[model samples]
Target: MTNTPANEKWFQDRATEQIHLEQLQRAERFNGRAAMLGIVIGIITEGLTGAGIAHQIGLGPLIDGYTACRTQFLPFCF
Candidate 1:
């Protein structure tokens, strides 16, 4: 069987659309991974900053203050 001009154009268009869709999906996945990595780094940095602050002020007092603050404020925030 032979393909007519219209059929050839249709096939080409379909292939192009498939390739474009795949590229978009790959871009979205990469962006999602990057965002997740960024969140993880942010959490780690926050934890490190908190730890340094705790060390400077003394661990026992920091924990007591955090516990008291959380206990008082967390219920209202939630």
Candidate 2:
């Protein structure tokens, strides 16, 4: 347990690493919360729209376009 200069530097390095790890953990938690909020918002929007409502929002055209593309690019798709 000698309080040598190298020992002090090692302790400082570990402390810096620990601080970085804690910061990363906090950031991850914040990211998880943001993702959950987005999911909740999406669910609410989808529920408000109700089932079989995509046609009202012009998704029929989008789906038709996708179908056409898929049909054209059969090998790329399947």
Candidate 3:
């Protein structure tokens, strides 16, 4: 077939689609690896400090406060 404008546009569109698909795959791979690394780090920290990830990150007190407030039926809890 001749190298018409329509053919050029079609080829460009296909190329763009292929590039986008590749980028998405790469991003997904990176996200998965990062999540796995975070889990491993959390486990190591917990083993070393005898504290869970939430406690290490200071969420323990916040959670405890929420639980206490819920049980006490505090007016501001809602």
Candidate 4:
């Protein structure tokens, strides 16, 4: 069809809508990364707590520090 005023308006509206959608997607991505970081910090905190407990009980040799903790709630060196 010919590029009439109505057609131009429609295109502009579509473009605006696309920009809004993209903005929302970026916000979601940023929030998701932040949430992941929080989760990792929580895991590290738990690892530290476990290590402290092991140390208190004289079991420090069985596991590593919190930095190497993965999968298991506590870090195990061996």
Whose lDDT is greatest here? Answer: 3
lDDT by candidate, in order shown: 0.77, 0.78, 0.91, 0.75
lDDT of 4 by residue, 1-78 (tens): 689999999999999999999999999999999999977776776587764545555666554544456557564633
Model 2 clashing residue pairs (backbone): none
Q: Indicate the TM-score of model 2.
A: 0.66
Candidate 1 per-residue lDDT over residues 1-78, each given as its tens digit: 899999999999999999999999999999999999977776776587764434444586657667777889544432
lDDT of candidate model 4 versus the reference: 0.75
Error of 4 at 17 (Å): 0.6
10 residues in a row with least lDDT, candidate 1: 49-58
Give lDDT for model 3. 0.91
Task: Name the runs in model 2 displaced over 4 angstroms.
Answer: 50-64, 71-78
What TM-scores do the predictions have? 0.62, 0.66, 0.77, 0.60
State the lDDT at 3 in candidate 4: 100
Model 3 misplacement above 4 A: 70-78
Q: Summing lDDT over every window of 10 consecutive residues in candidate 2, give the lowest-scoring window.
A: 49-58
Better by TM-score, candidate 2 or 1:
2
* Candidate 1, lDDT over the whole model: 0.77
